[model samples]
Structures are given as C-alpha cells and as structure tokens.
Target: MLRLASSFLSVPSSLPHLLALLLALLAPAASAMELGIDRLESRGFDSLKGKRVGLITNQTGVNSAGRRTREILAKAKGVNLAALFTPEHGLDGKELAGKYVANRKDPVTGVTAHSLYGPTRKPTPEMLKGLDVLIYDMQDIGVRSYTYVSTMARCMEAAGECGLEFMVLDRPNPLGGLRVEGPPVEPQWISFVGQLPVPYVHGMTCGELARMLNDRKWMSAQCKLTVVKMQGWERPMVWRDTGLPWVQTSPNIPRADSPAYYVATGIVGSLAGLETGVGGPNPFEICAGKGVNPDSFSNTIKNLGLDGVQVRPYTAGGFSGCRLVIDPKAKGDLCVLALALLVETNRASKPDLFAKSPADKLDIFWKVYGSTTIRDQLRQGTSVQKIAQAWKPGVEKFREERKPYLFY
Candidate 1:
C-alpha cells in the first residue's frame, strides 16, 4: 500500500509568496475557448449588417452561453435575418441519420425553414434569389460520411451559382485536427454522405473544409468564400479539453464519446443490418445484434492485445455482449477499437446478418468506409491488419496534401 503523503510536494509557510504560488498551481486550470459564433457576435456580426442573410444551422449551432445562433441573429441590431435552413436532422436535431426531414417553421425565430436534406439537397435558385449572403454554422464530427460537410459544400456551390457570398463560422473538429485515417473515396463512390475525396476521418473543421472544397474544386461551383476562424481553438485539443457543453448533434450521437464509437461500430450495425438504437438514448454502442457470448468474445478480444481499447462482458436485462471501451490507459490510437472490431468480427463465423451480399449492400456500407474493396476484402476473409497496411500509403499522401489547408 502507498502512503498518501509520500508523493506530496510540501509548501513552506515561511515563504508566503511561494506558498501562494503552490496553491495557484493546485487549482483547476480555466479554459479560454471562445467559439466562432461568440467571436462573430463580439465583432457585431458586421458581415450581415445590411445583407439579406440566410442561415444554415441546427440546434447544435449555439454559442458558449447556449443561445441559439438564429435567435441571436434574428434579434441582433443591424442584421436582416431572412430565412433558415436545416440539414439531415431538422432544426431541432431530432431526426435520425439517413432519414429525410421535412421542412418546418422554427417556433423560436419564426422563420420559414427549408429542408435541404429532403427533395432538394442543393439550394434552388428561388431559395437564393433574394439572399445576398449565406452563413453556415453547424457542429460536425471530422468524418467524411457525416452529411453536414456535404450540406455545406452544396450550399457553397448554390451560392456561387446564384452570385451570392458564403461564409462558415468554424466549429471544432471533435476528433481533433491531426490524425487522418481510412481510404480516400474514389470518384465513383461519391454520394451525399461522402462527396469529397477524403479519408473516413478527415481532421479539419467546417471552415477549413469549405476552403479546401473551393481551392480543390470539389464543389460543383465555387463561391466567394469566407471562414470565421475560431478564436482560442488549437489543432491538438479535443472537445472535452475545450470546456464547452456537448450539444447532441444528432439523436444517435447523444454524448461526446458517441462519435468515436460511431466511427467503430456504426457502420458495422449498418452493414450487418441490425437495430443500432435508432430511437433510444444510447446508440452505436449497443452490441445487441446476432452476437457471440459476452464473456468468451471479450476474453478473446482482450487476449488479442488490441491497442487503445479494452473489452469486457456487459450484461443487463438479459442482454449480453462486449462493451468496446475506448481504453484511456492504452497509449495507442483511439481508432484502434473501430479497426480491431471490424477485424475480429470478420474473422469469427456467425449467422449471416447481411440480407444480401456485402457487394449488393455497398450502397449503404460504402457511405462510412468509402471503399468497395474493403467490403469485398471482409467478404474474402482478409485480416484487418493487412487491410490497414494496404491503405497506409493513401493515408500518408492525404496527410501531406491537406497540410496547406489546416485551420485550428
């Protein structure tokens, strides 16, 4: 047993100044992360002062004080807040992933809201006719499959087509802005979910991504783009380190840790054709499909020496499967859990969860993973380590290519 006082650094009361300094050092560190919206407000939202402004945001588009962006803009002095737009989730952030949300009026701001994820993904000429500028402020995970970036890309193109300006109030990339993973999407596999030819985990905020789209000509057309760079955000900080409240970006991602799990198991649920807690509070973390025994699976996985994650039998209310813990103790990539899960599950034989062949289901599976070859390799019983090795070259090339556009 260890004594509590053994590791203590003693303070000297005889040296009063030194004692005060020690106390200060022991205090919790304060965070100074001001969001882009907060900075925009401080500057008096000057860009929208005399313009007919159309805002594309959701419930996650709020400031540090938890005030909705449109509410503040609609009531701000000198700003002509015209209309509102929403993406895959409605303005409320209640809609499920891949489901189309119908356009509805916002009760708070009383603006005519259009559903961009519905009938027309890209804004129509009518939507842009009277607007001088389009401002977008949506919180997004730094993944290619998430539709928010795709929505922003379309809006930029539409604004350019109608001769209007577009601006993005940057948000933090929750996965941080350093690691780039997975395969670069081929042109033929491009869809609403994965439009840009980036990896599954492209580590850039919305503003940076918009700039890349314009510079790289990823969008159909280019607009006069402006990015409101976030103050006090660094490239190395994750969401928890930023000290801001975690607003649910979607019904599925209810907490901060959920996005990481989604990257690992969400696609597994989709390809396997199982219920991934769509309406429930917790999603993507549930291991309740046609699963093997919890104890056996967990022991085997733990013994495999998987990096950056631990698995244990989770049993509650007659349900049992392993909980894939993003093991904080391990000095390994946090994404290892996702990669290892795919590999382990692929090796084990179980009931066929896919109603059709994975090739037939590439339309859905390819959204997140962004490669038909990955699906085919899994089908062919290829090891996950081998697959990762094959993709390492592409991942390295992308990291260098995206360096010029880094904004944190």
Candidate 2:
C-alpha cells in the first residue's frame, strides 16, 4: 500500500511527452477506459472492505456501466455503507441551485443522508461518527466556482479534522486537462464559489485538485488520502474522446459539452440584464440582452477571430445575441471569449452593463471571475486582450504550479 501511494505521488518530469506518446499508442482502446468507480469495483473494494463508509455524491456519481456508487457500495459484500451526503443540487440532482436541502433517509438505500448544502456546509464531528472513511465521487465541469469541488474541499477538511480517511474516485475533466485559463482566486475574495486558489478554468480533475489541496496544506488539516485513479484516461481526451456516457451534472449543465459553453459565457451571465439562456433550450450556450440586435452581436463575436469557436445569430424570449458553438479541442481561451462578450454588451446596450448592475450582482460577478480587476478594466474601457495579458502571469504561474499534481 505504501509502494502504491508512492507511485501515485512520483510523477516523472517528462510526463507530458510520455503521456502524448501513450495516448497515440492507446488511441484504439480509448473507449475501453475504466472510470475510478469501475476500477475500485474491479479491485474488490479492497480499500473499503469491512469499513464503514460515507459517500459524498450526487446523480453524476455513477459507474461507467450506469450503476450508482451508493447502490454499489450498499450491496458490496464486506463494505458497510453507513451514510450518504449530497452537495448543491441534492442527491437526486433536481433541487434548484442555492435552495437548502434537508437531511433525510435515502429512499433507495435507507441510509441517513446528510445535506452539505444546508445550514452547515461541512460535516460536523457528530456526522462523522462511526465512519471509517469518507469517499467523494462526483463529476465536476472543470471550472472553478462550480461549488462541487468546493464541497469536496470542505469535506476533506472535515475528514481531516475527524482523523478519518478520505478517498477520491477520480473522473475526467470534461474540458480536457490542457486548457487551464482565467485568474487564480485572490485570498480576500475566496468564498464557497471560489474556494481553492486555482484558475477559474483550472483543468485538473477532482482527484488531482484533492491531492494538491492536501500536499499544499490548503486545507485546515491533512487526512489520510487515497485516489482511485482512472484507467486509460489521458490529458488530451475530452468527454467525447473518453467514450463514457454523459450524465447531467446540474440543471444548467445538461450535456457533456455544456461545460465548454459555461466557460464561454458564465461570467457574463453573472452580471445583470444579460441572459445566457438560463431558462431556454441552450443553457449557457448563448449571450443575449435586451435591445441588442442578434445579427450585429453574432457578427461582432465572429469577427473576433477567436479560435475553437463559431457564432450565429440567436434570439430567445425578449433577448437577442449570438449562440456560441464551441470546439473544445481547438486552441482557444474561453475566459477571453467571455470578456469579449461583456465588452461588446457594454458597447451595444443603452447604459453600461457594469455601471448599471446592482452592487450585489457585481459582487457575484467578481466572485465568479476571481477578482475585481476584470470588472474594473471593463468599466475603464480596457480591451479584452489587455485584460488577458495582465492576468496571463497568474494563469501561467498556475499552469506551471499545477504540473506536479496532474495524474494524466
């Protein structure tokens, strides 16, 4: 077990080149990739055998074969599934965002399921009682401020405080692992949305982030940590490349490709008076606002020459703008695309979008964007290119700092 842990920690410095070569060699068998849950099951639940386990999961926590991890562990021969925990949207993934979910008995497993999104965000010592290990298994959209990763980090801290083992069942970052973008969270602005000090589009998986959090002492305490890594997943492979089924991560993120769109326009949506297709068919896929002409907006975005993205005029409800068609494989910074959209909206709208926005909304905007710098730059007429350049140092620093934590 010590040897296995050491091997997981010792990443070779030439990992990038080696990983590219490995991907080329394993192209044919890419579809045969096994998720962390699948690998854990195949190992006969060795790490969890005869242990009382608590699971932090939602609808996205499923094996590649479509079995829920909660159900799997409940019936595993020697594994005693003691408790269950739900994050933002609740266990069923149907609860509305930010709505409090109460603790209840899980209808399927009859386990006492706790709510991490309720009055208390972290599990208390009483909640950790009788549990030997806490396992985390949820699919994240690969963007910061999504809150699931925050819940994971808070849970890790709780587990550490309780001196319990914390295990992460690794999953692939749907946006791929090479596309790190946006600024790191500043110390003063860290909140539930931006818990970790990583980029807005930090491309590492939940397991990698967990390892970084543990090793860097980002958490209050260090727990005995283990990550059941996936088999055949590589850094360059996006969701489609993995051949895994897509489960709706949340209400807005209803598809595998939804994360890319989220990155493109989520920041813009945080401000007032713009609709990013929240209630429409294409959530987070369009940038629209009142009094804006769809053709002009679409043409403006198209003319930006942003790689990996195509734009078309789209009108929905009372708003009109462009529907973004994002190609995740191509070289493009989604964060820059968001900034451009904001700038264009400010120019097209009657009053400045940033100036007219309420203070609370602007606070949410800064929180999601990781700083007040971009908002200030936009209000002062700083171009998106200049803003990107200014934050480039922080993003580049994060890219280099994150190399050792990456598993693929």
Candidate 3:
C-alpha cells in the first residue's frame, strides 16, 4: 500500500537507522501516534515560560509521556500557569455530551478551571483578563460538528477581544488528510457547532485550521495567533501511521475507527432521528433508530451494492432507543455512506415524505451537506448513484480549495 522503504536512503552504514525504521515499520498494531506537543524539545515548550497562560483542553491534552499538560507546564522552568479552560467534555473528560461544566479548582494543580462549554462556549473578555496568552492543545475528532473546532474559534475571537495571544498546539484530524469531504457550511447556518465554511471532514490538523482562522473576519484583529505545527506529519498520513497513543477526545469516540464511521453512519443516525450508539462500547457501530426496521433497511442497502461499505443490523433500547445495522468498513467514505443510506431508505419508506418536509433537527447537518441535497435526493426517489454523482464536482472543488491547508 503506502510503503516507505525509501526511508533508509538517509541512513549511514554504521548506523542502525534502517533497523530502527524496520522495527517501526514492523511495530505492533494499535501503537499511539506521536503528536506535535509530544515532541516538546523540537516544538519548544520553553517559549511559554514566564507567560500567565490559560489552557483550553480536556483529557486528550496529556503529554506524550502520559503526564497532564498542566502538571508538566507547572513544573517547567518559568511557566506561570494560572488557569485552565475546558471544552465540551470538561477537564476530567467525565461529563456527558453537551453538559454544562462550571468553574472550579483543579485538585492537583489548584489552577482555577473555567468551563468553556457551559453558559458560554467561548472565553469572554473577563475570562481572558490577566492572561498573557491562551494556549489550546486538545485532540479533535476532525468532524465539523465535533465542537472542538468551534471552541478553538471562540478562543481565538476572545483572544482578539481581550488583546491576548492565542497559540494552537496542533494534533492529527484522526480521519487522515488524503481528502476533505462533504460540503462547506453556509455561513448563515453557522452556530457554536460550526462557525465557518469548512467542509464536514476538514483534512487539516488543528494548527493548520488556526492559521486559516487567523485570517478570517470572525476573529478579533488585535489578537496575535500562532500555531506550533506537527513535525514529520504529512498530508497523506492517517492516525494509523502516527506512532502515538489513542486518547479518547470525547466520550463516544472510544476508538480511531469511531471518527471514520462518524463521517458516514453518524450522519445517517442523526438525520433519521435514530440512536447513533455514542454511549455504547462501539459508538458508530450501532445504527438503529425509532420505528425503523433494521433488517429491512440493512437488506436494502446491501442490495444497492454500494462500494467500500456494508450495513449490518443492530438493536438499541432503554436510553439509546431503537436502531439499525452498521458499516464496519466505513472508514474513508462516511459522507458517501450517509448519502447512500438516505437515498436507499427513502425508496423503501413512504415516498416523498422527506421531500415534503425535510428534517431540520440539527442545522449543523444541513449546513455541511449544503442545501439538503442528500435529503432532497432521497425524497425525490433519486438513485444513490445519481446523488453521489452529483456530489463529485463539489467534493473535487472542495478538495482543490483545501490543498494549501493540507497537513498529515
């Protein structure tokens, strides 16, 4: 597949470079990726010395060595670590999705922890008071609706508002960087969920996104923004190649494949008003919903002969509710599966129901797909192939537009 045997060209005969590379190449599966901040010596954490900093992160902010960032920064020479700000999942990563987290003292560091996901999902002028710079170093699930991207955007805006500097310690997008899928969100439908026009699966890392956001008008002109880029990462390398650990960014994303399936089945679950199995052992693996026939729906999709994925039946109840099967192979084609599922389900269900009145449960979905094309196509009984064909030009155009921003 993506063999890199050429990595040995730089090695000297006396050195064990090839051996090391071979060992790495042969490394056991599930080894974690070494992220940007993990290479602290190269990235220069010392630049943060003497700065009264407020950090925006959650459990995924651990150092490569598994130490917490606040702990490391506090012990480092000259760092005046003052406060901590948490995102959607809260500081400890224990809070349920969308739950409010209030300000409290971190039991270990005693740093005042502020909740960015509570009443305000952004740092207010008061929140940024006395802070020299606001540093963001969280793992993003790489989806437009994941909320971490929006959190970073708000932090950048607040930095501008209060004349504070914003630094983004980037991390991989988990879904890899080969392609940016789905449609760019319409600015009018922008919410805390999504504040920009980026596609559903933006292939760039957090640092690259910060650079793009720094040029946008939504940010305060006065704020100085900087991104510490990831080393040895390229646009084509997915999370599997990163040689680092997996830390769950959100409660539902328990594994790397979760985000991959999220791009596809997640959309289907949400649009159909079904249980996405977020809280289960395999979040995206479950695709059941209320009033849905899991077997029939699964058969319909299987009969469509869609490439690169399979729909398996499943059932959920008690809080999760009813559902359908899953596409375990749905790694790179989440949006494709989303469109396919929508198109197929409509043909088997009552005709034109979605066309008469499309579901508007989450504006974020509509924003990304660009004008409800998936739902509209389904309602009109359009074939899955036709709808996918229609999205080709838009997907290609978006991939081209995001070329400059690509980072592995």
Candidate 4:
C-alpha cells in the first residue's frame, strides 16, 4: 500500500495530462472571438448544478461562436436553466426602443421570459422564488446612462432580497477598458439613468462595475456574487480587438463607431432639431439642430489643434438633419475629439443649443453630461479643453478609487 501510494504521488498523473492534452486540442485557433458563456462549458456549470437559473440577457448576449445563452444553458450539463429575463430590447431583441415588454414564453425555447423593463423595472419575488441563481449577460455600451447597467443593479437588489446568488457573465465594455472619460454623476441628482456616480464612459467591464456597485453598496450589500472573467482580454483592445462580431445592443448604436462618436456627439442627442442619426446609418455619428452653423462649427474645431479627429459637416436634409460624420480615417485621443467638438459647437451655436429639450434631441445628456464645468464653460466662453481639464481632477480621483475593482 505504501509503494502504491508512492507510485500514485510520483509517476501516475495520466488523468491530468490527458485533460491538459484535451484542452489544448480544444483550444481556440483564432483571437478576439466572442468569449461568452459558451466558454463556460468546459469550465463547468457545477455551481448551478440542479439549481434553477434565471438569465437576464438580450440579443447581444451571444457566444463568440454565435450561440445564445438560453440555447447554451438549456443543453448544458447539470444546469437546470429555468427562467429567462430580458431588458429593454426584449428576450429576442425584436422590440423597438422604449417599447415595454410583457411576460411571455420564448417562442423558440418555451422558457418563461420576464420583462425587467416597463412599469416594473425589476424581478419580483415570484420570479426568484424557484431560482437558485440569477445570471446577467447583456452587452453594455460603456455609457453610464445606457439603462442596461441600471437593470443589472436593480436585478442585483431583487436577487439579494430573495437570497439568490447573482452571476455576471461579463463581456467587453465595447469602448475598451483603457480610456475612462467624462464626469462622474452627482449622487444628489441620481436618477434611474444615473446611479452610483459612475462616469458617462467608465472604463471598466460590466463584471467590474457589478463588484464596484456591490462594494460601494450601491446595490444591496449582502448579495452573493460571482463573475466569469474573460480570458486574453487586455485594456488596450477595443471591441475591434476582441475579434468579436458587433451585435447592436440598441437600435441607435448601429456600430462600434457609434460609441466612439457618442463621447463627443452623443450629448448632441439632447439638443433639439438634431436628428441624431437614429434611423440613419450612423446614429451618434450625425448631429444636427435647427439653425446649426455647420461651417462655423467645422472651422472652430479646425482651429482647436485637437489631435486625432476630423469632423466633416453635411446636411441630412429635412428629416435627415444637418450633421457631422466622425471621419473614420482619423485617429488619436477620444477626449481631445470630444473637447474639440464641444468647444466648436459652443462657439458656432447659441446657448440655445444646450437649452433645447426632447423635441430637439434625446434624454441622455441632462443626466450624463450635466457637468457644472462644461455648462459654465459654455456659458462663459471657456475653451472645451479648459472645460474638460477642469473635470479631469474628478476623473482621476474616480480612476484611483475604482482601481481595486478592475479585473484586468
């Protein structure tokens, strides 16, 4: 028995070697592929074995190989995938923007799909009563006011109330993780759109944000949490780096450039007469308000010497709206791009540009871009760079405070 035990400890690791070889054989051949829940197959569903799971996901919650979480978990070994929950876009992502979802069975999987939007923006006790775990896997646009994160936070609270474990199967932030920009939301004015004082473009993954919210007690403090971290993802690589295909998480964000332009031009979504390219090829890429001075705005940015971006002015016609396309060929820094455009807009247009309401634009800016510095700068003729720099201290402080929660 002693000799057998010695042999077992010394030269008898065939099982491990075989497992390693098998994994190597199964190793992905390509880079930047969609690294979603499908990767969890070999990682095992043992944590959820025999437990009913409620999944909150949307059309973008797909594996690199193009499989949905619902389909994957339904067939996953030992996982009793019970219920399906959806955010703004509905379970299949067919609903149009602002369209409320009603509880219904998934026509494809026959699983009960609950709407976490509309009059009730959270999961109720009935939804959690039979579930052992609640999993979230939506693609976020990297903006604070995008609503997906809010849904995640609300669900976290609901899961905690029912003693259910919450799991975040993270995907990339789409805008990448290196560039944290914009101002932090003020806590006093916190709304459903802006919870937890995160920036408009917080450079952390959804999983990291989930942990931060829990740590900050922005959500319930006692919720059980687990995050499935992404492998091979680094901060420098944007969605383009992930080699993952772009899935439009919302109607307006048609492409990766939409968020790129979002930092600079999306605030224009709040200005009136600007069509905002909602139905066009590039949503945030196009901005137009009635009586917008396209030539002056263009010349203003040209003189800013802001490195890395060029905006070409054009008219979208009556419904198309006069707009600017963020020149795809240009490249440099994002904030510089934003500052240049903002300074130019303020110089070329009236304070009325900022004063316009929903008839003129969307509802995102009054909340996300409500920085006192920027507002005062526009009011006092301060340069956009100066305005942006004024907010940098706050941004730096947030970055330092948020470091502990970063997974990468």
Using TM-score as the measure, the top candidate is: 2
What does candidate 1's lDDT look like per residue over 212-297, in tens digits? 88999988789999998888898777788788889999888888767676766766665653434556666766554344566775
Q: What ranking of all candidate models by TM-score puts the best one first?
A: 2, 1, 4, 3
lDDT of 3 at 330: 32
**Regions of model 4 farther than 4 Å from truth:** 1-29, 32-36, 318-351, 358-364, 370-377
Model 3 weakest lDDT span, ten residues long: 318-327
The stretch of ten residues in a row with the least summed lDDT in candidate 4 is 320-329
TM-score per candidate: 0.88, 0.91, 0.82, 0.84
How well is each residue in 1-408 modelled by candidate 3, as lDDT tens digits? 225445545447835866788888998765345555666534457778779989887788876666777777667677788889988878888788768888888887888889998898888878778889988889887788788888888888888878888888778777767656675566566776666567777777888787777764655453687777676676666666676667877788877667776776666555544456677777766555445576777776566555556567665562222233433333435666666665544454443324333456545456545455566556556776676666667668766766665454
Error of 1 at 403 (Å): 0.9
Measured by TM-score, how close is model 3 to the native structure? 0.82
**Winner on TM-score (2 vs 3):** 2
Off by over 4 Å in 1: 1-29, 273-278, 303-307, 315-320, 327-331, 334-336, 347-362
